[model samples]
Target: MEKYGVEVQEKKQVKEEGLQELPGTHENIVLRFAPNPSGPLHIGHSRAAVPNAEYVKRHNGKLILRIEDTDPKRVYEDAYEMIPEDLKWLGINPDEIVYQSDRFDIYYDHARQLIEKGAAYMCTCDGAAFKELKDNCKACPCRDNSVEKNLELWDKFDTMDAGEAVLRVKTDINHKNPAIRDWVAMRLVDETHPRLGNKYRIYPMMNFSVSVDDHLMGMTHVLRGKDHLANSEKQKYLYDHMGWDLPEFIHYGRLKMEDIALSTSKALEGIENGTYSGWDDPRLGTLRAVARRGIDPRTIYNLITEIGVKMADSAISWKKIYGLNRNLLEPIANRYFFVEDPQLIEVKNYEGGKVIVERPLHADHMDRGNRLLPFDGSAYLAKSDIADGVFRLMDAVNVDIKGDEITYNSTSFEDARDLKARIIQWVPAEDNVNVTIVMDDASLKTGLGEAALSDLNVGDIVQFERVGFARLDEIKDNELVFYYAHK
Candidate 1:
């Protein structure tokens, strides 16, 4: 289950430290996973959610689920609904759901107070104008407007056109980073928000809403992507200016690489352009895709735990993830029979009787017991395994096939002992049982006609006979069912 490169010895030391008792009583600490409702969450988001949830659980604290739906135009209904479900699928439960769109008045009230205190001002410069002006350029004429005039203009949100002007937090333009230099706090948006209809016009940006909410909600510790480390400094500045207490900031590295794009906008573009099937495409590192691929949440959690809280950025290979999943599922999965590309074989010279052969449901585990399989003097086997004009039948006999007829050379069953290549799976071809297996579109190509077993009820995990572990998605009557398997 170890995905990270950390040594087992080191992990034991860390685990021992984590198991030690805390020096003080647990505080009423609150951590948050503030995902923007712009697109489906990818695997990078899972990295954050897993650790934050684990930390909260370890310390007996609260994990708040916050939807940063500040962008009116970009917010999607599906994104908001799927986020909580995805987190729950990963075993991370939140104590409360908070939407930034619901607190526009609070953001505005604080924005206005900053204006009254001469800490913020309205800027009429558009994007092009600001880009041309740059840092050395003169401040817009509206920057010097009286706070009373700004308040009067702010109240006219109902009449203002979108992007006509914006409220900017007052910061030194000469600051090292341009983001700290009078960043926009709020702007008018004419589009309707999915959650909050058209009740308001102006919306707060990430810098504004995150700072205000984190302080108000009493978030004692913040764990976020490393890209926000610089933004944290700006937030710290805001807290200092407002005489508010600041929280301990922990910035972890992002999971990214040149080939992989974690951006929601990029993912949407891929979906639209047919570069990917959907957000849950197996090729994409999204939580839904990982879950659908049968990777357990415990494995994902263990990977993050092994990686620990490091500031260095790293990209994980897909093989490593799959390997960990295989390890976690190996001991628990059962064994069964599955014959793909089945070829029928008819017995020619039998002793006028049907012979029943039984094999245990699980190998090396007697508790699983056995199932009766009808067999005659002959049995169908996979055609691909036959080689060089010779066929081995469980090593007990050798057969030659010519013109749909198989000729056996040996008659003793003892000769088949310990024949690894001869071992194969079989199902009753004469049986009337029917099963329909549902798989991701990507896997459908290579997995066709491979004894796909799907006759399972919901919540049932059955061995795919010999293929792998499969869980029943849904079952209709006793004939048809849909199943998903873990590789």
Candidate 2:
């Protein structure tokens, strides 16, 4: 085998056994969403996961969820379970689930084969020296080491200190991409893996292990970010050497959202430092955070599919995303009145007894039914919901209020809509229910909601008439807690 030169592949090499193309049938495809168990799935992950899961479904194929838990240092105990839960919440179910830590023997077997074939060697070069060589496109002294010596060093993973040895694949040292030159296939990690503990010190580097797994797992197509194109090329060397057919590669561009803290490191760091509540903290960009802020999973699916599998990076604004969701929510979300920063005003001509008021759950969706509110002598209104003049109390009779003076007017919905009256939301004092609205910014707004809100269960999405759409989080005692989604 010539060092730093492409090897001639066997002429009659065919696809692996069991992966043979069927007669009069299509190639059975398999897709995957491989997320390392380091953190919960973020919106950026959704961009990757949605397409993989969607393609498998459309093609009537399989979607394997391979947890890239090979990096012992980055793995977290909670994330192993949390990642799957987040995916389940988003309605993405994997056909097969695998953990890399469980497949160490498989990776080790493949690594040994490469070493025996003189296709890979163990290099003892330090980080600084390797950087210097990489900078100058110079091959390190260990690049010419004998196969027997490299195999001896590779077998010493149990005794060698971490970073004492690295198993490097044979590649062009003068390759245009410095990062691609003789890529490390395996390295000794000192850290105790969350799942594997210190049971294994020899860890297979990403491309080496991924190539092995994809071939053995029968992955037919790989749909991933364009950033992984270089990785795909590097992995191809392993496939061609092992006489495995290359999987169909469909690389899409990155999807970045404006104002979102997309870095998993920063988000996880914030959580650990008490800067964020958890993975679901509204300040973070994780899918749990988006759901906690009341964005629907169905909406997320539609958002990603709309972008499709593009070649160019897609930059999106949160406003556009919420605007689309608002349209989807309006028809289904029940309407209620909630008065925050509540100001009380006395209805001057009101009788002592309460006046019954019927408010429709949805003005256009009559099938949603109505809720009844009672007005005695006073009404609660949001300070921002009213002007200094007469306005129609939404779904009820017209009310004239200047400063604190409040007087009743006509009971015509036609007049309110026709005159383009300023529609204000109000909760009669008798029908007020203490409520807390959690805004997307993580602030809590205390308000008084219509008592009818008591019928709403947790997870129900409701609109606060003139306010915004909010998802019910909880109800304790007489108070209703909601997560304000968007208008």
Candidate 3:
């Protein structure tokens, strides 16, 4: 499975997934995961963050967790704490944590240096007018502003009103990419920053702050998406003007995940309007959301490692994740019976009195012990599983179902096998615990679980026999709440 010097994951039963080697050789490989404070990390973010952390681990280098909070209007105050928490749950621990919002002075210093070198200037042109000039490959009148005047405006930048002036980096006006034509380095954001408040108004743009910090932090290698190719080019100009060496930039393709909501803004809107429960709502692709559904952090690690750093775009489905997660959960997760939309079946002609059948919690690991299921001539079968045919009540007895009447046929598992009867999951008719499963689509599936489920505590991952895997989220006074993961 090796490709382009990257270690490939073997096809079957590998202990751990492998990652491809980074492009260049280096004594110190410094990488960073810079997430914006606009929202918590989603599934799309892990495509960039996990590889950086894994590469650092493989090279024995430093990994930095930088929170990009330059945009005050987009910043969600709570994400300042939530981002790191999510990373911790994913088993990613950074060597250093940095906040772009905390380094305003650093950015201001670099902005001044760019002006002194005539690499940047203050542009006071109207937005629409500047775009027309830029589109026509013509330099603005402010492009030739004296360094002294630009520095003077820089000193008075904070006092200026929003959109009054902007500091622009000098680039080729005739460049093929219109976006590269003298991009804005600093702007006046009138809104109050979530962290620093109204202490400052002049904030460096994303490229300016990112470029400055990436160099100052001694990053040796940078992992980015192909969409950021233009951004990388834009940043190199900043490095060139500063007389600093550029870090090796590795760009991968866009990762598109189907049937999952990855937009933090939309998720927040949904939460505000009562359309979603919270950030951990099952419908979202947030790490917390996946974690709530019994998805192991190792599963996420394996997924990214297997995908590696390919240059081509990757499209994935939730089924791929469920398949990987099931392998990790199968041997460890204990099994139990849960009957959704239960139908009562009275077992006639049964001679047994208060039959209690003990089944192994896990078939492969009998040493872990067994769960007891008591049947008192009455049991519940899922209504969907009940048809006009013979079926086996799991480890109990074989029965024939003929138009609402269930009669005991035999007790031998062999007889049920010979009759080709379907092995169906069942819960005792009495003392079954009420259960509510929060499906991945955020729909609720209410059902009855075996009485033995009462002994389990929250945060436990278990299989619901014929049903799929689920994480016990909460235990109410009369019911257990679980979030469905996958089949």
Candidate 4:
């Protein structure tokens, strides 16, 4: 799998330094995972969270959970709620949760301070006026307004509804980067914010809000997607102008691809158009979807670990993700027998007898011991295995299949060789065993009562012995209901 871009950058930095750790311990070091509440976090967002939380944890520092809800037009209620929940589910519990919406007053105060310092001014130039000027954006005629007049305009801005006017910080319009040319610090937006409601209109842009919040939150490090590196430089300028302590800024490459869309807007459109189930749809790669599909949090952590944090952008494969998940789950998952598309087999002419088959939970690890399976004369085995001429039952016992008849001589478990043929999973049909096994397609319904199955509960994970890993999807009236293992 291709490594994440951020991982590449980190490697280069480390090679140059010949060390990973900073010189001395910065005991007060603080990091943050600031997710915008415009949409539920996707797999790409999860990638960002892993390293950030790890850095804080390794340093025994604080990880602040901040919500950047400045984009009032795009923010959603459910999206906001999901931000923290997803982080918590991933085993990343931030020390504090802060919302930019709640800090409007603080942002406004800073905007006023900039005005008073002659560093910012109100720009009434409408969108049309900006487009007409194009590359040579003419400085607003009010750019040189007196401090007294600017304060009144700032006060009016503090009280006006959103979208009314914008406060732009003074910067050279001829600067090489267009983004550095007097970007808006605050804008008047009257739209109803999903989280804050109609409380106020003035909202800070990302560059302004992040810089202010990082400072106020006492953050010592700011690690984010490299797409925001330019914005980081802009923010550094603000910190310099204000004479405030500047945090270490590290930008990693963004998680993106050619065919795969990463924009929340595109995701929302897919849901609205009925092209996807919802934000949690497995196909979308959102955190909820990945969780629902049985991808463990540790798998996500390991995935990012292998990729490392760097500046070169890359695309990760779902296969690599599953491989990690399988490794993580191998030790804990209980083994059971499940044969999808089962074919009933009868040992003709033999008296009905029962055999206690002991199958190890993990084939490679004997310390896990074996699980007991009550096998009767009649059992359901995979139809494909029966057609393949031979079937190896657990414990290295081979059952020769000729036409519809399967003949096997009883053999001592100790003397049996490891099953050379595929070990076909079986469920005792004569013992009234009820199992709700899931296949690649539809879920199966066995006649046995659902209560008898062990290690199968809603959300409980299990490996169907020789079949595959699965999660209990539903359990009702003592029946096992499982979903196909995602890993």
Q: Which candidate is the best by lDDT?
A: 3
Clashing pairs in 1: 336-465, 336-466, 337-465, 395-416, 396-415, 396-416
The TM-score of predicted model 3 comes to: 0.94
| Prediction 3 global C-alpha lDDT | 0.90
- Which runs in model 1 stand beyond 4 Å of their true positions? 1-26, 257-284, 347-353, 389-405, 409-414, 417-421, 432-455, 459-470, 474-487
lDDT of residue 103 for candidate 3: 99
List TM-scores for all candidates, in order. 0.83, 0.90, 0.94, 0.84
The sequence of per-residue lDDT tens digits that candidate 2 reaches over residues 1-487 is 5632434444455643321222222346787899878788888888888877776666677889999998987887788888889889889999889999999999999888998888888889997898799778998898888889888887886698888878888777787888778889998888888888889888999899889999999888877789998998788777876779988877889888889745888887888899878888776788888787678888888788778777689987888779878988888898888999998877676554566888788889887787998877678889886666667776666767777677776558887776567888888877678999988878899989988999888989999876799989888997888988888
Angstrom error of the Cα, residue 95, model 3: value is 1.0
Error of 3 at 69 (Å): 0.4
lDDT of each: 0.68, 0.82, 0.90, 0.71
Residues 226-248, candidate 3: write the lDDT tens digits. 88899998998889999999899
Least well predicted 10-residue stretch by lDDT in candidate 2: 16-25
Error of 3 at 6 (Å): 21
Between prediction 3 and prediction 4, which has the larger TM-score?
A: 3
What are the per-model C-alpha RMSD values against the true structure?
6.0, 8.0, 4.1, 6.2
Query: Whole-model lDDT for model 1 versus the true structure?
Result: 0.68
Candidate 1 residues 325-345, lDDT tens each? 778766665555544455666
